[model samples]
Target chain A: MTNEEIRDFIQTAIAENRVMLFMKGTPEQPACGFSMRTSAALNALGVQYAALDILPDPRIRQELSAISNWPTIPQLFVDGELVGGCDIVTEMYESGELAQRVGVEQPQHEPEPPTAEAPQSAPLGVENRLS
Target chain B: MPTATELKERIESALPGSEANVEDLTGGGDHFRAEIVSDRFAGLSRIEQHRLVYDVFGTEIGGPIHALSLKTTTPEGQR
Candidate 1:
């Protein structure tokens, strides 16, 4: 699909689904770790949501990033607005904000064990470790 | 691929007077986490704040830079 068509498709999906996720894979089988975590957060809450796999067409992600101005997959939209990506969603889920935003009660489950509250505050090193 | 320092420089230069701390999360040079403190982020929402940082990288994001996790705050919001 052309970029315009892709944008329209995204708009319709967002408008139609109260809770929509533009992820790399389906919730049942996520293609990326970030996607898995984000979807898990929603599932843990037991909130019904719609998922669209961006892997099928590269243009879907390209248009999504362009229209949302959020250059990331696993983008969540609530009530037709961009909520955020994994980190933000994870933080919010931990803080109980994500449940409220999605209009669902926080799931009754094991509370996240208290630890270092700061997210990725420590850096391993400056050198590229991938090499 | 942009090194952590190069990415940090780009962030700091893009948002003048802002303090940026970058880390190569996976050591693969693709995934990274950044902490940015600047008055520019003071009034923005979380989504907007993240977008500001993402805007600096533009199309490079999700391409050369596989992931850029961000933590943004204002000077007053510093911990």
Candidate 2:
């Protein structure tokens, strides 16, 4: 496939998938501790979503970073839009916003205090061990 | 390198009383594996369950802690 075609293919993957997280690891193995947290947040929400692991190829990550300008793993995409990073998801969760976006309930019925979360910090903007 | 205790504490502090096991899976001080059980996951789907764990760490996910994998179960677990 031509370069443009390849790019289009990737775009299709993003656009067609309702929930996409371009993470470093799989849902079962998050490859990074932060990714694990992000993965957990989504799981807690109780939504069926697609997960793409960017660990298989350096070029895949490189191309995605170049195309999206997101220099980090665990990049989340909802309805094909780049929905910030891990911190962003956490923030949305606290505000009862991400649940709305993803079409699920807050699931915060736990007896413990709802420390839920709010977009904290994503090592995304930090220096990284580039793949 | 974060000890298993530190990892467990950090995870518990974030999610609270959540039945989780945080271990240094790689002995690299960075790689971790967390298997959590909680009522908070009662009705949520599989993907959603995983996201909650990642949300706690936020971006620190790929930072000081390099890799993290997860397995989440409801208080009742699989049917």
Candidate 3:
């Protein structure tokens, strides 16, 4: 598809889905760690979301990065606005901001917060660390 | 692939007076984690701050640099 067509496709998808994730794979079988963590955060919140796999077409990612100006996959959209990727989503999930943004009631249980102060530069667990 | 030091230098140079700490998360010279503190970030939202850093790499991002987990803040925001 041409860049214009891809842009249109992305715009339509965002408008059509209230909570959407442009990820590497489906929520059930995410291809990347960031995708997995973002999907997992949405699942943990029990919020319904639409997942589109970008692996089918390289143009999907190309167009997405161009339009979003965000050089990452696993991009989440809520109420038609870009929320963020795994790190931001995971942080929001921990802070209860995601639920608020999604307009969903928080689940009865919450995940435990980090217990120890980590090294400032340690890769956040949600990020990909594959060599 | 750009080394973590190279990426760090790029960021620090692009945002003058910024402090950048970059680490290769996987030692692969691809996936990286960057912690940046800059006075330039004072009024920007987290997203905007991140975008500034990202723009420095432009196409290198999502290409040679497969991932860059960013932690950006103003000096005042840093702990």
User: What is the DockQ for all candidates, taken in turn?
Assistant: 0.66, 0.06, 0.52
Interface RMSD of each: 0.7, 7.8, 1.0
Candidate 3 Cα RMSD after full superposition onto the native fold (Å): 7.6
Writing each residue's lDDT as its tens digit, candidate 1 over A22-124 gives 8876666679988888877877776778788888778888788888878899899999899999888887888899989988887665476222222222211
lDDT of 2: 0.66
lDDT of 1 by residue, B1-79 (tens): 7889999999999999999999999889999999999999877889988988998998889889999988888999831
Point out where model 2 deviates above 4 Å: A1-6, A110-131, B1-79
Two-way DockQ contest, 2 vs 3, winner: 3
TM-score of each: 0.85, 0.51, 0.85
Any runs in candidate 3 off by more than 4 Å, and if so which? A1-3, A111-131
How would you encode candidate 3's per-residue C-alpha lDDT over A1-131 as one tens digit per residue? 57678778787778988987888876767788888878777777767777788887788888887778798998998888888887778778887888899997766666754221221222212221111
Docking class of 1: medium
